[model samples]
Target: MSDPDLLAKLFQGDPRSIARSITKVESGSEGAAELMKAVFPRTGNAIVIGITGAPGAGKSSLVDKLALYYKDQGEKVGIVCIDPSSPFSGGAILGDRIRMATLGMDKNVFIRSMATRGNLGGLSRATVDAVSILDAAGFDKVIVETVGVGQDEVEIVKTADVSVVVLVPGMGDDIQAIKAGIMEIGDVFVINKADREGVIRTQKELEALLGLAHRPDMWMPPIVRTVATESKGIEDLSAAITSYFDFQKAETGALKFWSDALGLENVHTEIVEDQKVRVAMLPIGESRIELLEPTSEDSPISKFLEKRGGGIHHIAVEVDDITASLAKLKSQGMRLIDEEPRIGAEGCLVAFVHPAATNGVLLELVQTND
Candidate 1:
């Protein structure tokens, strides 16, 4: 990884390099943090999907099918399966090589299984870092599949852009706690094993429960029924996910996760117009979030919504010297979307790096007068 060429290979979507990067992160190698920081600018393009549910609820099966569905659409998929740790071995017993045999055959699909290894918190970050590696390596979709319906699983799922809570028919009132907790997190409700006897009953129960629960985002969680073995309802499930992704663009709830994680709160909010479209600005730290929800449907973010629904708005990094940095970048022959600095949110001078320069990620460089 110290070799510049070897490190560069991972950015080119080399599978071996990607695998080695994940291994380093999983093992907490010394260079792992630096590597992640370097790749951060290239991330935020891929869709993160979290699949979680109780054991035997067919969570993995649903993930497998949904991933396959995405692959069928010619998208590269990445899967990180969190398996229970074995006290004796301390390794993933059901490794990716063994469990996802079919997905393994596809060069475009990268699957890794991680053992809980008694470090639930560490495992969550490691799993997230692994997904970032795949995303930087050009994966279009990264799905994190975790077992059980506990707090640890909930924490891991919180890192996802969209989360799916898997369930099966006949769990009944015995799973009330799960419903209460998981229902609060799930963006999509999945009823797998739809061929079961109590399929309709489960759907009715989910609908009734959803009616009782309210989300601040106002995005209605869709119930999708699927028989994973037969790959039934996968298209419907995919559609449901895409629909939700679109619905969240106008809301600030999506950025709330990261803002809260960073222990930062929105200090001031104001509306700014760009090209006849109104966008919201919520300032944090020395940077501010330029929200993409547009007042008009003709702006760039609006077109982005029509095409890809809601995706990453942009990654803005602060720089001490914007002009000098841009000059150096130009001399280095990097493609820049904004050739000169302009006033962005909070009156910060900013410029953008073209996606061609950063692995399909839109990046903004911000500089403050201070």
Candidate 2:
């Protein structure tokens, strides 16, 4: 029950610890901060490959086959599939897991389905964190499969060291790739279900688009044809992936470019720090509340209502170093709900500054127990 023991078990690859850790992360539990803090140092070892494409692009099948290929090569694989959350149900469809049934039973393969949960970039953020956990767990390769090519999906794939964009023949919208902003991020393009008619046309169109893009890295993205159902071209697809990995490793320029582009380290640091502060500021209660009242008639809510709109009544911020940040805010002549911080939920320490302090926006600062 102690934090240190729990962290030790988690680092030792205990399944219960792993499951509990993921739950904490998903639910934003108070213990999650300590678990991640302990696990953070062990990460950055796995090869994270992101697979994304529009719906019905055979991405699940491709991921299944690709994972199997890696397994056959004696590599342990971790898969994080991002499924769309149902607006009404507030639950994930779990469609990706259903499609990847065969790989589910394999002990060497770990498949986790994540819901976007109305997070434009939340899914990607969580997916990257999940990948980091898997990486620290010693998975040789981690595959992040995301459904659809929406902006959020593209952002998710950009986090991967190698991003594979999946497309099928006869979609009649290969041009949509440009519009979706997928062309710039793809390290390799896959035409799944290659036996379908117009496969050649789709491949040719992709080539033409790539020709026009003229990447600054000067690495030509390779197109691989795959019949995922039959496992046809799976080898070629794997080879292409391997070749690209080698090329990137050799180029150094490409590796640096992607590292800077993804900025995964910074993201991880920010999230961990943010969560730490949020947890630390929570009071020991079911729901922690920090009330703020207007200091003047032109207070934050009044100004916001008058200028911006009626939506988004207020905003709260979670910071690692509340004292420092608050001091900076106070020095700027900002109004404070309280001159000092107080206890919040889950043993967290919290403080709320009036909206007038933050350009007509309410600001809250939380510090975690860990």
TM-scores for every candidate against the unseen true structure: 0.68, 0.63
Each candidate's lDDT (Cα)?
0.78, 0.69
In candidate 1, what are the lDDT values of residues 1-370, reduced to their tens digit? 4646646988888878888888788889788888898778889889888888877777767777788888889999988888544221135644465555766566678877775665777888888898888888889999988865568778888888889888899876735768766888899988899999898888888888888855645467999999988899999999988887767753656457647676555555433343333345556656666555555567777787788877777788889999999998899899998899987655779899988988899888989777
Where model 2 places Cα greater than 4 Å from the true spot, the runs are 84-101, 104-106, 177-180, 253-370
lDDT of 2 at 262: 49
Off by over 4 Å in 1: 1-3, 84-94, 252-370
lDDT of 1 at 74: 95
